[model samples]
Target chain A: MTSLLALGILLLTAFLLLVVALLTRNSTPRFREIPALTRLVRTLGLSVEDGKRLHISLGHGSLLDERGGSAFAGLAALRIITEKTSVSDMPSVASAGDPALGLLTQDTMQAGYQAAGVEELYVPTTSRVTGLTPFSYAAGAMHIASNENVSTNIMIGHFGPEAGLLADISDRDYVTLIGASDNLAGQSVLYASTQDALIGEELFATGAYLGAGTSHSASLTVQDILRWLIIITLLGGAAAKFVGVI
Target chain B: MRVLTAVIAIAVGLMVLLGYFFAEFVGIQTLLLNWAVILAGVASLVGIFNLIAVHTDKVRRAEKGGVYSALLVIALVATFVFGLILQPQHQIMQVLLNGIILPVEATLMGLLTITLLYAAIRLLRRRADVMSVFFIITAVLIFLGSATLPTGDVPVIGTLIRPWVSQIWALGGARGILIGVALGTLVTGLRVLFGIDRPYGGK
Candidate 1:
């Protein structure tokens, strides 16, 4: 019964948000400042101007897991970045820990080039399967960061404390690092190491923030509405409890 | 093709999701999830092949790291043949996992600790914020608290700060982060299920 109620609430909220988004087409929703994303745009521009490659690591997250949400968000960011860089001579490269993710990364890169009408510039070797395990993935990604002359490192997905190692590697190479991760340890490491680190749900906002489309925006809107509802519920419940009410 | 992919995705996603709530289609849900796992395993093999092809191309082009690529190929082939000859759970496999893999991973983990320490120092240098200072202090407290003193007793300062910092403060922050992540996951899953967003290279 609880799951049913939860599902009902979610579906209704999503539908209402979608309708509102469609009806309010004339007006645009304003988002607060996201420093990481702003910095990423500048870095991408710099990479293109300097003729240096952009390196993206999707981390060691499996696409089939429940926690794969962060990886999906990472992929959305990849799509947006790849599209932007597809027209440039220094195309962005992507690495993934999962084979399924690697294949999807390849597909996303191809789609980007296809959309840009620059399929010839698409290199099949750019999107690589770095490693299957978390630490190994970090080691492989570090190897690329040090050897590939990557100007910017955008690391996002399900990472652990190993993220610190990647950031260290990037720091050693003096490469700009933009990162996001769902792992708590990874978040701590990112906070300590990276200046522009996307924390928690901020990672989920990549698609909407990067202007993937209205669906992403609508979904983000629904998430915000639900969050507000949750806050109200928590506060009201606390008040009720304080007043000796159930 | 996009339309077909979307249709199939929605059908499969809804079926499996519905099966979780209603017990009648549990078998179907299990079957679907199993199929996904099996496909993932196959995709892993394909990824290995893809890696081989990529390295082969690098070796052919005589890239800067062509020697390393060649070495990787050699190691991969040797490992694969060895694993095939002596079953995966054999003593040799155990030796490889325990002796080689574990040691390498442990070394990386050790490096992670040093890297984290360096990063914390860098954080202090770069930001110099109260939060960074607090983070460093909490980390130091935790490390000291978890360590055994030469006199065989936990230090009083470490003991006093560790529980408050780790069990209460860190746990509360972690729970908040987890709640946010759970909500984000819900939204992401809903988008995929309802076809609001598709990352399968469709549309």
Candidate 2:
């Protein structure tokens, strides 16, 4: 015990930086434009205009795993979509492989409804568990994508290569595919299949980019600060090693 | 009410995070995590029941896809009954799990190859960006490199270039992505612990 010194320090630093960012930030943090996400919101608006359904899949990620972070980011994305769709009764459906994540997705939808003052519009069936495993999850989600009158399909979570099938479904049905995944294999697949693919850490910036609130933006700012710190540390270490300082 | 929810989240989250550093707190942290896991198992049952209810309603209403829903219910019942009677370790259970489920999963995986090809072909058509070009070129190189020649392994092309390209270039890119994902995951978890993000909805 007490051996995870690095982990403890990193966690503590992240916590402190997040607090400082939240307290000092007067306005929402501005993120560099991500075309796919920007287009995703626009496509969501179009779905509302066209009176079509929008489907979101949280993938086969569980909260008990390291991939939970991506799923949480997926929930943040659900919040963004539901918040917009709640205003106009644009039907939105959320599916997840894990029931626990499904429950969170449902809760996020409810919060969105609350934020939009449209609690009555929230439907339990809107966020449901589609499947338990990765391939099965993709298959179930693809069925919905193919059969349902979905205008847009946005998946941001912990998907594997199985996501390629869902992307194919999007393509076959002419549904707009906007996706992000934490898994490297899934990202590669998405790079090929999706119209807009958020690569790597871009998935985590969904909340900040969507302008959820200042707190969301603050979290992103903290991430950026830490990323710079890590980059500098890596460079310094390499320089020191090259000079044989040790 | 929201404040209470946030406070609870912060306390539980802090406990779990701190449990890594403090052995004395690990028991309480593990207890909470176990409770969550148990709750999740129960929630899964609820999800299954909810699915049944939804499809049952559709069948009752004779909706457009009611027949499909009815079929799904019938299949689910059949599987559940068989599993219950035979138990998971029985021959019939293995047949269903390994024989049927595994093949279906394998077929889906196979389909992904074609889908990836279709996507790669359409990639440049959709976005003619520099990255897209790089991606297509890298994919082509890797695809060609990984292929074994009929004459046997080509010296520089297969053995040297392929391994270097994959091991150095591709692995490097993959490693970078993993690092970025790790950093993102750390911050995202911290956001939840700090109560900046309220995914459970109350705060």
Candidate 3:
């Protein structure tokens, strides 16, 4: 019974996202996340004269694998951060494990910063290519986190169990922390977030809210509806199950 | 011919993807899974060949770790023979690996944690800000909550935190983070599957 409910929710969520993605693809890409993040940026200290560094990692997925697309989300997040950070004269640093992702992440950040009218805020060296091993990559990230003196760390992409280790260590040690990752372990780290903002679906909402492109905004609107439908169905199912209804 | 390759790929792809939802289609699903396993097993030989080629080149060049490579060969041969000759549950082989090798990795990880802890402490010394305060408070809370030690014996402290700690640490903060992460993951997955933002060279 529980299995059936879970499957139902999964299918419904997928369906909703599919519809929304299709509808909004050509209109505007940045949807829900832009305003919130822009407000967050305005709320932050741009007057301090240096833009905060942003770190975005596309998890352990291989760029070489034909199936790999985890890093793409990181590229997307880079665009928003780039635009916002640049306009405010706040610097953003983005990094990737795959060399391919490294190229894309830097390009996107540069584009966003250029849009924001603060091209200097985009530092190319910040988007690094590291060793392929998950732990080795994590170690490289840890080093960069310490060295760069970044104000916000944003992670968006696929992650594994090792992600928790980095999140825990980063939060425990550094004063600069803005974490966003799809890794299950990231939740534990994010839950502990105090000074920095750890966004949820808000990252997906970015493309639409910012009006970056059509497909992006549409996806967010669909995701919002889908998320609520899931909650309602699950709640209804639970209630029915308690009353002994199938 | 190219079209045939593409056709086969899409057909097999749908089966692999859809199999997750329709486990009731047992026969077809099992055949695909079994074939995947077999292919993976065959591919393991490729990795072994690569390892040998690299190590042989290292040994021939008398690289810095060439002796370590030589020792690895000796250990690999011995362990393979011992493993095949002896049952897995046999005492000696288990003892050597479990007793020695396991501890080494564990100790190294433990050492890394300790050094990491020290670095965090030092960072706190340098910059005493909002982010630092949040991180320290949360780490201590989680660590203390998970610890099963003689701390419960302490009258004022353990009793005070025991019940509420779970609510404060585990339920409140943990649940929020979990929901955020789940949402992020779901969005990411949708983005990939739909090719809205293709990182992979898309068709």
Candidate 4:
């Protein structure tokens, strides 16, 4: 079992390296002076708009945060947002529940805007610590998802059942909500939305999705290949064990 | 160099993964896991220090809502005292965490359900769309299915609905979502692998 699991890990690592190599061959994310999201909002929406809003929810973090990799996903997601949405001068609203997460998220969002050269759009009040409760967090997110003016709500991180309600509410309001939750129920909400679900490690794969940077995306891709390899290896091992092939 | 960190990380991950079924490898994995826990406990002090610094500075500046900072301090100290003063194995800390924090968190979470219900009911009300209505039906049915399974009054009905929704969701919707999420993760990881993103630098 250990060998199989390790084999999965090895396979994932190799795949990640491959993805990294492939992406590096292409251009990485470049922050535009004006957010491209503005075009989407201005041309797509009614008359005038405050531009699109990118909502990023950093998960509760992992049992092992030695390097803070879990929270790193949220921060990386913000980076990609900064690169794309602000190319034509748009805004993004971010909020968090965990204080530590709140602090980190604030920095990342601000950094995102700075990278895009539109730090002016970063809202201080919007990046508040929603609540100490899942419900309160849900309540706060629902407000963002359903409110007018905000175009795209990229909901990511550690979410629960209320997350489904929040994601569904975005579609209800004709707003686009890219929901990514780590939990099973939260994942189910993704399926309920106009888009498909982004669950588990996908929550941390934001950087790759938006073409933000390379390393994180590479690691994520590698994990996927590794996952499948692990699955196949299991069958191989089962056969071996059954026939005493070792 | 990034290579060193990447290599070590992959090595550790592989060892841990291998340790899953291999008893011999389990020893090293357990040790590494313990090291991880110890690291977490140690790094938590950074958070504690940050809290202290932020609140202390707020109290010193006497800023608006600084009193709330004081309250936070009070809460932290009170909780810590109760935790350390009581027997190490006692439920005192657990009581505080569960009794006080849990209820507040749970109530707040429960409140979202109302909003969720509203969002579900109002999904198609204000929109000029059919997909919104489709979403509404799916949301309502899923909600009802979930809400009903908990009552436990009708064992037969509960038994039927539980697996029904579970499989429908797991095999149907969940599987699809998993694929997207998987693809997204793969892409993101690839970007990272190529140094397209440097998350380690606090960006």
Q: Write the per-residue lDDT of candidate 3 for residues A1-246, one digit (tens) a residue.
A: 766765676666667667766665555343223333564455334423554455556665544342143355556656765665564443555555554455555566666766667666655554555434466456556554655555555566655444545565566655444455544354333434323434455544544443446556555565567667657877899999999997
10 residues in a row with least lDDT, candidate 1 chain B: B194-203
Best-fitting candidate, scored by DockQ: 2
Model 1 error, position B181 (Å): 1.6
Clashing pairs in 1: none
For candidate 2 chain B, the 10 contiguous residues with the lowest summed lDDT are B194-203
Model 2 lDDT per residue over B1-203, tens place: 88888899899988887787778889999999999899999988877876787678778988767888898889888898998898989998898889989999899888888888988999999888999999998888777777878987776767787789889998988887887898788877877877877888433
Per-residue lDDT tens digits for candidate 4, residues B1-203, read 65565556557766765686678899999999998777655544544545556556667889666787687778877776777789546787778767877787677566656655654555445443775666665555555556644555345334575457667754666655554455444444334444444443334
Q: What's the iRMSD of model 3?
A: 8.3
* Residue-by-residue lDDT tens digits, candidate 2, A4-92: 76676576667766576768678546568898889986886787788888999899889988989999989988988898887655569
Q: What TM-score describes the B chain of model 3?
A: 0.66
What would you estimate as the lDDT of candidate 4? Answer: 0.57
In model 4 chain A, where is the ten-residue run with the lowest total lDDT? Answer: A32-41
Restricting to chain A, the TM-score for each candidate equals: 0.94, 0.93, 0.63, 0.72
Stretches of candidate 1 above 4 Å error? B150-156
Q: Which digits, one per residue and each the tens of the lDDT, describe model 1 over residues B1-203? A: 88888899899998888886789879999999999999999989978887788778878999778898898788888889999999899998899889988899999999998998889888978778888898888888888888877776476756677788888999988987887787787777777777766677523
Q: Work out the iRMS of candidate 1.
A: 1.7
Question: Which portions of model 4 show Cα errors greater than 4 Å?
Answer: A1-13, A16-20, A27-56, A63-72, A80-154, A162-178, A187-205, A214-246, B1-25, B52-67, B87-95, B125-131, B142-165, B179-198, B201-203
